[model samples]
Target: MRIVHLADLHLGFRAYHRLTDRGINRREADVFAAFREALDRTAALQPDAVLVAGDVFHVPRPSNYALVQSQAELLRFRQKCAAPVVMIAGNHESVRSADNRCILELLTAVPGVQVVTENPEAVTLANGQVRVVGLPHNSLSRLNTIDLRPDPQVPYNVLMLHGTVDSSRINDYGGYDVPADLLELPWDYVACGHYHTYTHLGRHAYYAGAIERTSNNIWQEATEAKGFVLFDLVSHQAHFQTLHKPRPTLDLPTVDAFGKDVAALNQELAANVAAADITDKLVRQKILNLPKSQQARLDARQIRQWQTQAVHYLLDARPPTATLSEAIAPDIAASQGLTATVAEYLRQRELPKDLDRLHFVERGLAYLAQTEES
Candidate 1:
């Protein structure tokens, strides 16, 4: 039996403040496009079953557009393929409250689509030809307590779940750590999600990875191939299928700004930016060991203009440790007013470029003021 394993669609994930021609968030549109392409390819593959291990959405409560787009795609898949599509909730779409239903449960309305949201459950499909045990995302307390075992009676037993494996190279993203012993279970294959990078734990277990880049670790993830896995039950072999070409992302080499004046630093930066091809790419420039005084002297307007050269440009300037500590000491020592303190804190915080720092600081200060008054 042929089975396609895919995960971490992360539909509606938005970033970089870029808007499409239709005014939708560009990253969101890109994510949706990637999923759509995957579905199209899956339809052509015509596998006996499709396994979506977890993280169908970027958040539990997605935008109406995202919901509609996802529903439509699943319906399209249902119409095209005769195989059953089994899905489970990952941390992103898992709810903490029992009162709230997981968004994944809504997909059950689509024919041939089965969803597991609350707990671990075993589902048999294709007239007992395949038996899949699904463990959906739940609280860490529940994950640790749940029992997982393979059915010895089934000829093809697949274990599907979403979580990090102990000592895996992928980041956990605050999800439960699935013990490596679970992968060692006597199952034919184990399909996993939650880690955005594709990984093979052994001959039997695999993480399909996100179809599109979805985190700040894009620089690192870029080095790894991103896509889904096609597992043949009869042969016990898996093939990775690359679905989309990721948007170009460049992490420029770090610059040692020690002992350089602002003019010299700016010149160096300008030369690097010009020499490196950043056109229509997301780029990060790191200026290391620069003093606050020197950083202050740099032309902010000129640096800001670099954003125009690339699709998105981030200038990450690391002030000398002594300079940073000295800058923070006065604020804590003097106990600067709430607004000033909040502004300082926001300035030091690492935020996505899509967010407006000035606006965020204003809102934070306003909230703090209201709390003080109350």
Candidate 2:
């Protein structure tokens, strides 16, 4: 028996403000397309069963377009593919109990697709010779309370779940500290999700990761090697097959901008952008430790223009420092600072002479204004 393991599809996600032209989010379409391609590939491979660990949608309540796209893809899998797909809800989809009802209930009507959310359930596929024990997101709190342990009598058992593995890397997103002993169970394979990187816990435990570069944050590891894993039940060996979806990311040549002027910084930035190879990449550009004074000189329009022309993402990789804080203008930093500088600025001093004092006074007085005007 063969199974295609995929997880964290995150369909309907929208991102890259510049790349999205149809007034629709680019990430949404990319995500949907990824699943479509994966399904197509799965059909070609002719797997016996498909395992989607969790997080099929980026949000609990996906947009209508996303909903439609997801339905279409699943329908295609049911009608076209030879394999049956088993899926579950992850943290994103399990935000509310009501949210899971729409997708999970809809999937039940489909012949080849099976979805589990809210509680754990064991689905035994007699024809395929696979017994799947699935645990959805948010069920970890009640894991000890529940009595859903696998039957020792079952020979080939697979545990499908979505959560943060209990380890040093648990502090990251969507990660929880599940007892490490959970993997020590009698299950043959533990397929997990929520983390965007393909990883393994010991030997039997694995994460298939997200289908595509859903977020700019994950671009670093989003190399050529992106996609699902294929597990051969008879051989009991798993192979990570690389998906063809390409995301653009850029690495700007490092430059020390401690005392550089705006002109120098702009020159270097322009050169870096020009030199970057971003044909199919998402254009995640990183410039580290840029002088705050130089950054202050950048106009918002210019920044937007640079981002449009150069990359999908424009980021400052500078480490936060006291000198950097002092170098930047108080007004600029006030709006962009990590702390609430905008409120502090108003409390400290009166409005500047060039600035309209009336507007400031009106805003300040409006807070205390309660009476109706005649």
Candidate 3:
């Protein structure tokens, strides 16, 4: 009896908005293709059972197209692999309000799939003589007292779930705290999910991790080898099989604008981007410590056009400085132009692009003015 353990597929996840030549988000396409290949390999391996821990979608209410694509992929897994699948809802899909139901539960109606999202449920495969206990991401209070202990007499038992372990680390998605001792149940193997990175918490307890890198923020955390785990019941050990994914990444050299001259900085920037070797891959450039003078030198029209170019990601780090308007703020007499100046300052810096960006810019301008006066 063999099993395939996978987690955090995160279908419908999109980042950095560079579309493919076909006008589709390349990142989203890569993720979908990764899962398709995983299922194809699982079919070839002929696993007896398959386990998907959680965070199947990046959001709770994913677009209908995403849901349709997901269902189509699951159908392929069932038909081609001929293995029963056990999946649970992670925090992203777990509804906090009682008035709402979980999307994972809807899959129960789909043939050949078992979804456990409400309560702790135990199922036994009479033919295979295997028992599986499933626990979902729910109120810690609910699972704390629930007796999850499996029958020691059973020949084979596995625990499948999506939640944090008892370690002091917080969940990267939602900060919900999970106690590690939850694995106290008597089972042969405890397969977990939630964290996007693959790791082992304890003996027989493991996180399969996400199938592919989700975003630029998470790219640094991704392992060079990507894919799902093959759990061989006969050997009673899980082995990770590397899956090949073709995506490009670029690392930009950091520039110390505060200390470097304009001529030297531009030469360095040109050489860095030119040497990046991103001709055939997805491109993301990071520019650090850009000076006001450098910003003034850049062609604004060209820069704005580059935003929609093949380059999928960009990060600009610029030190706050006094613009011409701020140098003579008293004479300006609180004109509306002040707001536009502030907005342009924040926008060109490539900040987080959230409300925090506005807050940071406001606070930074105040600090810079005070420091300059003193």
Most accurate candidate by lDDT: 1
lDDT of 2 at 23: 61
Candidate 1 per-residue lDDT, tens place, 262-370, comes to 7888888888888888887778887876766677888888877788777788888886553434334474647776567656756765445799988887888889889
Specify the poorest-scoring 10-residue window by lDDT in model 3: 322-331
Give the better candidate number (2 or 3) by lDDT. Answer: 2
Give the root-mean-square deviation of each candidate in angstroms.
Answer: 10.4, 9.5, 9.7
Give the C-alpha miss distance for residue 311 in model 3, angstroms: 4.8
How many steric clashes does model 1 contain?
A: 0
lDDT for every model? Answer: 0.82, 0.70, 0.69
- Residue-level lDDT tens digits of model 2 in 277-316: 5544566545544545556775556557666564364556
RMSD in Å for model 1: 10.4
Which regions of candidate 1 are displaced past 4 Å? 143-145, 168-172, 299-302, 322-374
- lDDT tens digits by residue: candidate 3, 57-84: 7777877767888888888777776788
Ordered list by lDDT, greatest first: 1, 2, 3
Residue range with the least summed lDDT across 10 consecutive positions in model 2: 342-351
